[model samples]
Every structure is written in C-alpha cells, then in structure tokens.
Target: MKSLMPYLKARTVEELWEYHTKLMQSYGFDRLIYAYTCFQSAQSLTNPEDALILTNYPSEYIEAYIGHGLFRDAPMMKWASRNVGAISWRYMWDDPDNTPLGATRRELMALNKRFGITCGYTISFPMAIKRSAAGIGLVARAGMTQNDVDALWEDKGEELEIINQVAHLAITQLPATGQSRILTPRQSEVLELVADGKSVRDIALLLGRKVATVDKHLRGARESLGVETTAQAVRKASVLNQIFIVDPGTQLS
Candidate 1:
C-alpha cells in the first residue's frame, strides 16, 4: 500500500487510474471492474454517463451485459448494493441449493467463465457520504481457485481494502466527464440564482430580462442537466461544479 501513495497523489485522473490498475495486477488480479455512483436512487441507477466506471474487461462482453440488462439481475451486483464488505463468488455459486442461483444469474456466470472470470473477490466500499457507493471486483487469473483467492485475502485483505477505499474517495473528487450536455453560461446563471432562492420573477427582474426569457433559461438548465425539476438541476449542477465558482477578476453585480 505504501507503494501506492505516490500514485494516489497523481495530478491527473488518467494517471491515477493507470497506477491503480498496476497495483491491482500485482495482487494476482489480472482484470478489474470498478464503478461508483453519487446519485443512485430507489427508482434507478444513476445515468452511466454520470458515473465513473473503469474496467479492463472486453468491450464486447460489456456491451452484451448491458444490452441484455444482465446487470439488473447479477448476483454480485445485488450483493454489493446492500452489503459493504468483501464477498467471494464461490460462496454465491459453489452451493447452489443454499445460495439458489437463478437461471439468468447462472447464465451470466457461465458467460463470465468463458472469459476466465470464474473466481474472484468483490469489495463494496462503505459509503463515505449519503447517496453514494462504490465497489470493485478483482478477477483472478485463469485456473485460480476459490481457496487460492481466500489465502491471498487472508494475507493482504486489510491493505487491499484500504487501497480501494482511498481510490473511491479520490475518484469522487475528480470532475464528471462525458456528460450528455454542458450547461450554457446563461443557463448556469439562471440556476445559480435559483439556488440562491430567487424566484423566476426575481431572476427576471435582477437580470433585466423578460420573465419568459428567465423561464426559458431555467428550462434549458434542467434539460442540459437531464433533470425534471429546477431543484434537481441545482443539485446536479452543484455536484458537477457548474455554478458557484467565484472568479477573481469578475465582480458580482
């Protein structure tokens, strides 16, 4: 873990991801899939574009997984959603009568087996804040057994957990990328005023624009953020740091 501190302090997000991948490889995990979400809800998982997802799995496999909606029923995904700790795939699959693997889940497992993803540990990190969670699945090299993975964990579990927790926190601090849309300057201004508790009429008066124009800007902001309401737009914008930045050279009127 000491060897990872320098990488954790890397100046760029890409550098951090690269070094973390190397660290995972040294631990006997040849492939990894890590994902996190800050806006998960009971109704739906956060938009994929808004989440930070990193993996070395084949693109075709991922496309198939998503295209078939397998993630909704994946056994490990279900476990990670509710639990915060390391879980062995063996425990979930080895004793079918006790664990009762469903048909769809069994099929998914079979698909994974074809890619040498038969055994591994999944670490679901404790949430650092409300409404956010992250997890990582470390895939062992082909031919490794459950007992082999268990032994590895017994020797380095504590260090690995710490490394993953740090990685999650670091990822949360980086900016969101590949968003569906970016808020325009006018839209950002409208949302900022809305965040400050200003009403549509107040914003129109303050900005010296027609009430319709103010409403239009607010609507645009909501659309750009992919939210239904202005309040949601404000929350998503704040999360993305789209507003509330204080420029040193520009004075507020």
Candidate 2:
C-alpha cells in the first residue's frame, strides 16, 4: 500500500472515503460499506439516519440494506456487531448447518447472492466507548468465489487490516458533515454546551439567551437528531462531530 499519510490528513470525510474505497478496490474488493454510530444500542444501531455510512455498494443493494432497513437482517452486520477484527464471509456459507447464522440469514443471503456479493470480509474496529462502534464490509469483486477470497486474504490480509485500521482511525477523527443540516447553529450550540455539562439555565447564561429559548433550541436539536432527550442529542452530535469542534470539517455549511 502507498503511504497512507495523505489519507490520515484527509480534509473531509468524503475525501477520505474516496481514497479508502479506491485503496480497497486496488486489492480486489470492488465494493465497500463503512458504518459507524454512537447511537448504538444493545440490539440495533438505534437509527439508520444516525449512522455515518460510506459505501460504494450497488445502489439497489444499498437501498435494500439500509434504505429498506434490511441491514438489521444482514449476516455480516450481526457478526461485526458482536466481534472485533476481521472475519471471512466464508464461515457463514461454509456452515450449512446454520449454527451461527440466524433465522433471517436466508433472506439476506438470497439478496446478497442475487447481487453477486457472495464473498467478502468484515472488519469490526475496536471501540473504547461502550455505546459506539465502527466497521467495514469489503465485498469481493464479481466472479470471485469464497476460495478466491480466502487465497487473497491469506496473501494480503495483514496489509489490508493495517490499511483499514488506519482508515477507521482517521475517519473517526474527521467530522461527519453529511448530516450537517440535522441541527441549526443555535441547536448545535445548545448541544455543545450540553455536552460540556451545562444545564439549560447555564447554557442560556452562556449563550446570552433566555432559558426558554435555550430549551427550544435543545428541543429542536433533539427532534432533528431523532433523539428523545437533550443528552441523547449531545452524545449523538458529539459522535457525528457536529459539536465541540475547534476546526470545523468540510461541507458542513
């Protein structure tokens, strides 16, 4: 792999994603889906809208996976959620007895098979925070079988893991500006103060606004972020890098 210093210094999430996708493609993984969320719960990712999803997967597949909320049924998603580090997709297919695969795996498997995405690998990055996680799925190129993926992985697995781990680290540091419009300036300000351990009255005092107005902003932020409370909004915004920024990221205006 080329020097990943450029990718580490990527100015925008889009730039990093583009570079990472191309990098993976060069190694024969033609499609990728990078997902991260701070709003993760014990069962689900909480909400698809809250996720930072960077993908080069087919639109039709993406539509079903995320748009139609089929990601909940995705076999790799299940694996990534439970474990860290890399795992081959061959395990699921090889296990005909379906000991590891779930009840919904059949449907998702059929969908993936239809799209020629039968072989791939999922790397679940380690997370320090209990409620946050990040992972990537590398779909093997068309006409590649599980055996082909196995051979490729055996040869280049170490380099691939290092590159992807670097990408994951770099990505988490960058602002997820794709959801920039999810909060207005006032809403973001309120959330930032909230994240700083400010109460409503304290935030109002700091922002030179009425407590009621601050509450309104907080409420708006929660609603916009699809969270039920201000604390949740703060956590979500902080995870997305929509709050507590020193140097703002790109395309956030």
Candidate 3:
C-alpha cells in the first residue's frame, strides 16, 4: 500500500483523482466516481456546478447519469448521504429488511449493470463544514461480485479507507477546476479585487481600466462562477481557489 503522504501532498484535483483511481484499481475495484460539495441540502447537492466531481466511468454513462441528474437518486449516493464510512454495494439488496431498495434504485441498479458496475463499495468521508459532504463510489471490475469485494474488504478495508479519506482531504485543499467555467486571469483578478473591498470605480483606477470595463469584468466573473451577484462570485471563487491563489506571479492574462 502507498503511503498517505503522497495523497496529502497532491497539488491538483485532477492529479489526485488520477492517482486514487489507479490505486483503487490495484485493489480490484476499477471504476470510480468521487464527489464533494459544500452546498449539500436535505433535497440534493444544490448547484451541481459548485461540487467537485471526478470519475473514470464510461463517458456515455457519465453523460447519461450526470447530464440527466440521475446521481441524486443513485443507491450508493443515497446511502452515503445519510451515513459515513465504507459500505458494500450489497447493502442495497442483500438485507432489504433494514432499508428496502425503492423502484428508482432498482432501475438505477439496472442502468449501472449495463455499464458493468454491479458490485463495489462507497466510502463517505466525514465532513466538518456545515451542509458539506464528500464521498466516492468504487465499482468492482467486471466478473467480480460483492462477495469478492467483501472478502477484500475484510482484509484491507482499513488501508483503503484511509487512502480515500486522505485523498478527499487533499481535494478540498486544491482548486476544483473540473467544470467548463474555469476563471480566466482577468476574472480571477476582478474577484480578488472585489474580495479586497474594492468598488468597481476603485478597481478601474487600480487596473487602469474604465468603470464600465470593470463592471463588465465583474459580470463576466459572475457568469463564470454561475452566481447571480459579485459577492456570491467572490465567495464561490474563494472556496474554489480561483482568487488569491498561492502563485499570483504566474497568473498572466
């Protein structure tokens, strides 16, 4: 098993997801999806754009699942939402007396089976922030069963759980530049100025731009962050590390 130190030092979300995928595959669980959100609620992870989601599932499966908003009802996701720690996929069907699988979950299971995602585990990370949650779903490789997964877990679950939790922690420390709305240098700069309590006119003077141009930048940032206001944009950008970054010297427009 690899040391958790490597994951602790991960520099980017993509790098961390890639390494974690490879590590999980070495343990017989091949395909995986990871999600983290600070905007979770009783209903759903409000604003999917605000979440950090990474996956190695087939592109078609991802398109169908996320594009249609089906992940909210995924069996493992439902399990992860209300619980923490590692659980086997069999928990959904094997012991129905405790928590019966609904019609939606049964259909979701069928869809997963179509993609060779039959048996696996989901590890929901313990979160410290209010309304925040993070978890990963690891699908066993083709031809493997939940019994096989349980066998592996009985021996190596502790190490796997530690590795996943560490990776999730590393993800929180990095920018979730995983969506189409990556902030340009200009957008990031405008948000940074806004966070510093600079008015549009003040930013215009500081950046040698017109007031209207500064407003345009602010509008662009709001659009990029999928927020309705400059304040929201600044808060979201700060959470995602899109502003006040560690390497401001390298952010060339």
Q: Pick by lDDT: which candidate is best?
A: 2
- Superpose all Cα atoms of candidate 3 onto the true structure and report the RMSD in Å to 1 decimal: 3.5
Question: What is the overall TM-score of model 3 with all chains considered together?
Answer: 0.86
Would you list the rank order by TM-score, best first?
Answer: 2, 3, 1
TM-score of each: 0.78, 0.89, 0.86
lDDT of model number 3 = 0.80
> Which residue pairs come into collision in candidate 1?
none
* Cα distance off (Å), candidate 1, residue 154: 0.9
Candidate 3 residue pairs in clash (backbone atoms < 3 Å)? none
For model 2, the stretches where C-alpha displacement exceeds 4 angstroms are 94-103, 248-253
The C-alpha stretches of model 1 lying farther than 4 A from their native spots are 6-8, 39-50, 94-101, 128-131, 178-193, 201-214, 238-253
List, residue by residue over 88-147, the lDDT tens digit for candidate 1.
Answer: 877655442265668778778887877877788999988856776679888888778979
Candidate 2 clash total? 0
After superposition, which runs of candidate 3 have C-alpha atoms over 4 Å from their true positions?
93-103, 177-181, 248-253
Q: Output the worst ten-in-a-row residue range by lDDT, candidate 1.
A: 172-181
Better of 1 and 2 by TM-score: 2
